[model samples]
Each structure stands twice: as C-alpha cells, then as structure tokens.
Target: MLGELAEKGVRVTVEAEELLKSREADLELIVKLIGLQKPLISKEDVESLLKPPELRPVEVVPAAAFAPLAKEFSSDIRLNHTLDVTGKSRTRGEVENFISYFRNRYERLSRMLRRNGTVQTDLADVRKRLNERVRVVVLISDKKETKKGNLLFEVEDMTGSFKVVVSQSRYNEKILDKARGVILDDVVAITGKVLEPYIIAEEIEWPDLPVVREKSRSENDVATAYLSDIHFGSRYFLEKKLQSFVEWLHGRGEARELAGKVKYLVIAGDVVDGIGVYPNQEKELLVKDIHQQYAMFDDFIASLPDYIEVIAAPGNHDAVRRGEPQPALGKDLVSSDITLVGNPSSLSLEGVKHLVYHGTSIDSMISSIPGTAYAHPEKVMVEYLKRRHLSPIYGGNLIIPENIDYMVIDEPPDVFHCGHVHKNGYVQYRNTLVINSGTFQDRTDFQVKQGHVPTPALVPVYEMKHGRLRTLDFNY
Candidate 1:
C-alpha cells in the first residue's frame, strides 16, 4: 500500500506510516492527515481508494456542487464507527465497549445537529446549569420499598433508563401503593429534577386522565341533543328531510313538546362529503372545495334556532388530520353560539354526563366481534370504555394526532353518544346509555352497491329524571 501511494504521487509521510503500523490510523484520521500534508488530494481521490474502482464519483457542474467534503468525511467516519460497534459481540464485550457504543451514538447525533445548524453550545451549558430537568414518560419496571419508607422505582424510556424515589409521605404512599403491580409497559409521565449527574423525580402523573372540570354541574331545565357524521355535502345528504325535522322542532308537535327544553346541540364528525374519499365519489360531491363545503355547513347550522347552543367537532372530512375525536371546528367557520370541542368530549348535560365520540371505527370493531355488528352497534361504546381508548387500534380509517394525547375519562358517563355508520341504534351498558344517532343523509349509491339499506329515522329524545330515564322516538 505504501509503495502504491508513492507511485500515485500521494506522499506517505513518516508519521502517517508510523500511525498505520501502530493500527491507530482510522479512515477519518488518515483523511485528515493526508489533507494536511497534500491540500491538492481532492475528496474524490480519497473516496476512490476506499472502495471498488467501478463506484467512481460523478463530476458535477460548479453551480450544482455536491455537499461539503467535511460533511461527507464525517458521515463516512460515523458509518464506519457504527459498523465496528455492531459487528462486535455485545455479551462478551467489556464495559468499555458499551461506553464506546454510547459515545459513537452521541457523536453521530451531534454531527446531525451540526449539519442542521441547530446545535447550541450555549443552550447545552444552560441545560447543565439548570439541573437537566427532563420530562419522561415510562412504565414502572419495578418498585422496591426501602427502610426509610421511600419507594424506589425503576423506569425506562425509549432512549434509556432512570429511577424515581417517592418518599413515605401520605401523598406518596397513596401514589406508590396504587402504582404497585401495575402492568409492565403501562405508560406513566414522570417529571425528573436533575440532582447533579442523576435525576430526582419531582412529580408523577397519569397521562390517560381527562381534564378535570373544577366547577360542579349546574342545575338546568334545558335539554341538549348531540349528534355527528351528517355528511351534508354528499348526494345522499337529506336536506329536505332535515329541513322537515327542523320545522318539526320549531313547530307544534312531539319535537315541540321539548322545544324550550333543548338548550344545546352538538355535531361531532364527518360534516362534509370528503374529497376523493371513495372510488367514483366525484359525482356525489355537492361542494368540492373544503372551505366552501364548511361555508355551506355554516349556513345550514345557522338556519337552526339561535337560542340552541351549537357545538361542532372536526370529522375525517374536515380540513384536519383524520384522527379519532378531533378538536372542534375553527372559530372562523362557526357562530359564537357554537362551542367546538374534541370529537370525544365529556359534557355535563342537565346533570347527566355524556361522553361523545363520533363513531368512525365502531363499524369495523362491531364487525370483528360476533353479535356486535348485527345485533347492537351501540354496545361497542362499552367496548371502548372497557379498553379505555377512543380508537384503540392504530392505522384504522380515522386519523390520530401525533402529539396531543387523548384525554381519558376515568369516571364513567351517564350517557354515550356516537354516529358514523348512519345507523340509529341504542343500548344500555350498566348505568350508561349508548346512543348512535342515525345519519341525516339518506341511502347513497355506495350503500346500494354494497347491498346495504340505511334506516331513515327521526332523532330519538331522552328524558332524564333523577337518574331515571325515558326514551321517545320522533319517527314522524
């Protein structure tokens, strides 16, 4: 190799030869030394020596220059380091090997930060001084009770490991006692305050709990009906029938009997005929543009009586990620009378707590579980309550948000309402009433093709009196 380098006009300095003989000359060290000795050895020459001759560097225009030579060199260094670590026997290796692995990973990550120009040395110093407060969510791996009454918890995160000590105070005792025997991998959020090199936990919280409402439920005589997934922009959208039902609400009839009673209205999801939603769907869309579709929906929602409180949530069709229990519509789209909330919002209605999730995935779940799809679609709400997830299965038809965690309601609701399959159904699970309000949209060509006929029915009314209830159907 030395004689070949000399023949190629590449000088092998005495120190470089000594380093190579000592087996301490890594690719990066060699490149750096070569560059220092001979500034004329372009990056291409170094790359050619590293690999097979067929893989030659392509010449590019000066304007379309390749990335910096230093960057390419650093990347190659990191790649070689990774390969070296991965090829070694992890079990037989000493602690030094583990340290080397970690160091390499950290250095590679640092290189990535430097490349992006996002590395802040000042911020790192500040982080060290600030005690390195890290917010980590992990499942409690194991817990040990010490003589001092402090509970030592071993926690693990995606990156690495940590520990939490809960002192034997009344508050901590209660928390630790509850945490014992928790399923391995049950996620919990822990806030760690750095105690020099180690982190001391300041607090631990359950991420699944719903936002607690501080105020007590107010006493009110007015009633509210919540429904969603109307899909108003579809050809099957029943504008005339919906108008008739609206007329019945304002006119003197069964719906009018509870006219002044209904104080609020909520539409949960799928408010529009989604763009390119299904095959041959272009012809069925009454409103093409998403913003315009929402505009039309605004007009329809506005047509309702002003006295009724309206709450609208974003559905799969709306201009948001196709996730379960999405947030309410933007303020620009709807009137002040409306309060938009997440798809699955807990509302205290006349002292009756109702948990509403626009039933998007209920059909699939129901279809999977025997007797659920045919006999009762509403019972699937009970399944969700049992699983403690709005949409437990990921990659379902609905979209879930990446960052914002879904709030879990520990306290069961008095009623649960959902609508997506466009089937009006009802069932009772323990003390909770599960209601799936049928869609306002009538049968579509898709339904006909699938040999499924949707039941066109009016909204069902419920009367709650001191935990007792009565169901009334307004089919007319």
Candidate 2:
C-alpha cells in the first residue's frame, strides 16, 4: 500500500505504513484515500479515511465553553429501538428490493388509513362498482393542474390505476388544501367514483393521527434541551455565544432555574462542520481535519453536565452515510457517555416520546409543499405528521431502500424534533409539539446569498411537566 502511495507521489508516516502493511489492503479504500489530495498520510489520516473511521480527539470545542455542573440530576433517556434503524439495515439495493420497499410502505400506510374506517373498496373493485362513492387506498404516482382550475392526478394500488380530479369550483377548502399538499409517491385514501375515464373526488384522507390527541408529559419537572447544527469546526461557529450557553447549562447565567431542570439534551445532528461537506467548505473550516472536527465536538459534549444525558443522531454534515435514515454516529465520534442513534430516531425522555430527526429532507418538503420555508421548518415538520411519513417524495431526498421503511412516523410522537435549516421554530400542532432547534453557527456566505437569517445559539428547552417550550437566546 505504501508502494502504491509512492507511485501516486504520496509519502506515508512509519505508523501509517505499519497500519497499511498490517492489513490486507483494500484497493478501493486506498484509491479514495489518495483521492483526498493529501501530500502526507499519517496514521490518523489513514484511520480517518476509512468509512466509519476510528478516531480520537485532537482539538477542544471552546475549552471555556462550560463550567462544572453545580448540581447533579438523574438521567432518564430511553431509546425506542422498535422505530430506530440503527442495527437493522438489510438492503442490497437490488431491483426487487426497491419493489418490496415501496410495497411495504404502501401496505403499512394503507393499514394506518384503514384504521380511520376509510377503506371502502380496492382500485379494481372501484372499477367494477362504477359511479359509486367508494374509498380506495392508493399511492399517488403523478399529479398536475388542469386548465379549468381543477387538480388532476393519477394514483395506483396493487390492483390497478385510476385518474382522479378535484374541482376548484366546489369551494371545499378542506379537501382542496389536502389535495394541494399531495406530492408524488404519497399513500392516501381517495373517496371518488369512476365516470368511465375520471374519478370525481369527494374527499381525500391522509393516514394522519386522530384530530384530538393527548400530549404526554413527564412525571417530574425535569426538562430536555434541544439544539443542532453546532458547526463546531466552521469559522462561523459562535464560540463565545456557545460559551454563554454552557455557562447557562451550569446555572451561571440567566434562566438558571430552567437550566437546573434540564436533565436531558437532544441534539438532532450537524454537531460539527464536517470536512468537505460542500464545495469550497474547506476554506470556511477552522479545523481542516475531520478527526479534529469531531475531537472538538467530543470535547464540547464531554464538557456538559454529566447528569444531563445527551443523545445525538447523524445529519448531512456528519460523517454518516449520505441518505435519510442515516445510522447512528459511531463511538469514534463522541465518548460513550452519550447515546447515539440513527437519524429520525424515536426515544423516550422522562416518559415523553420524542421523534428526533436531523431533518435533511426539509429541503425536499420546502420545495414540494407550498408555504413551507427554511425560516419556518416547524410548518414543514407538521407536514411530516400530516402525511405520517417522513420524506414522502421518494426522489426528493436520498433514501436507502431498506426492506423496512423506517421513515414512517408509525406513531404520533409527543414531541417531534428536528434541525437542519439553521432556523429556530417551535409550534404545537394537534398536541404534537414540533421544534426545529436552529444552529449555533453564525451566518455564512451561502446563507447570505440564499437570503436566510439564522437564529444561532438560541436554545430551546422543553419543559416536561406541562409540555411547555421556551428559548434561551445565547447568541449574544
């Protein structure tokens, strides 16, 4: 392997040489390593180059970020493994896999719709019973508007396909609103009857939760702090503001009382400014090495109050696979003191079920759904609940065709949490609290060009007892 590197005009340290020589070299991995455009390869470089690399801390994340916790609290974080895709990835990406994957999604969501007592007939059965109002569970394949201000779409089930249309002149805002939000590849129940060529829609129903829901609360007064998009290794990372945040966590600043009640901290993703995440991202990185980036993240997380049980998931920027349902960050990224789960992981904190996602697909939702924007990600998060499926548009985000569809929001969570757009937003929809806990990094050139104003270093704390949420502005 060292000889191969030599041919590529690359020099390797003695440790790197021993590490490479010790193992049966993987040619593809070596090729990727050389592709990094590094002049010298050290043991650290070799180690970091491996997928899900072995790592150790190299830089501190604002060494003065935190003071020691004045008081200790009991931790009560329980991960719901049933919905987590951590250890259960089993897809080979074969042609059959995609078929079975979407089939499973249709069936699961179909059953959820059935629970609403809306399954009146199958698509084939609907064709048999012409001119009859029969509800059929169908996955929308394509949609477009007509010249007469009507929404025309095609939907399909295992049995057959049907052309459906909803008239704008009908003035039914409820049905029109639902129809407007329907993107491609969404599973829904359409109550319409066949008229030889078209199915005139009467109502459209989603596999959403009950209109009335009971929000659960923790037994104790403990709270959980939500945050993400720390971008620790980026030049825009707000170090002094984060220092204030850590001080607040130690009951040293304003909202000291609230800080004392924070027994858990949930960070959805983007804990660090990952190397090579975007074009020319290197120029903005304070720490160029990926290992050092995570090292800084580790130090910052390690500096937090030990009693505050921390849970982290992966994001687009993190060193995880490039797709939704990203598996948990490995122990190499952070200390074992924290719990790591997959992106869009479900877990219980103090008896309150919280759905935590890195929310990379917010971009897709914003583009597909009208009135959804980066500044108001909570509105997009609500769409996820309404559809009861995260990343409903198959091609909108990169998805692994795993046998099981982990993106399905099988159960409406007490709290739906995500972070990706670097915007702070919180809203309670139908008893489900939705939160997009902004970023800790200041504005960047990309955001400036995109006209996005980020609410950096603003922390959201969810009070468990009353399902109340409040933000602490540490951006100063």
Best by lDDT: 2
Residue-wise C-alpha lDDT for candidate 2, range 1-476, written one tens digit per residue: 66676777878889888888867757876787778787777888888776484568778655344433324446677888978888888888898879888998999999898883444677776667787777888999999988877899898998888889887865666787779888999899888767867788878888887788777898888888998999889999998888888878887877667888888889999988898887899999999887888888888877787777888888899988888778898877776578998998999887899999988889988998988888799999998998898889998989998888889998889999999999999998888989999999999999999999999988999889977789998856
Candidate 2 clashing pairs? Answer: none
* C-alpha RMSD for every candidate: 36.8, 21.3
- The sequence of per-residue lDDT tens digits that candidate 1 reaches over residues 348-369 is 6555666767777675566544
Candidate achieving the largest TM-score? 2
Steric overlap count per candidate: 3, 0
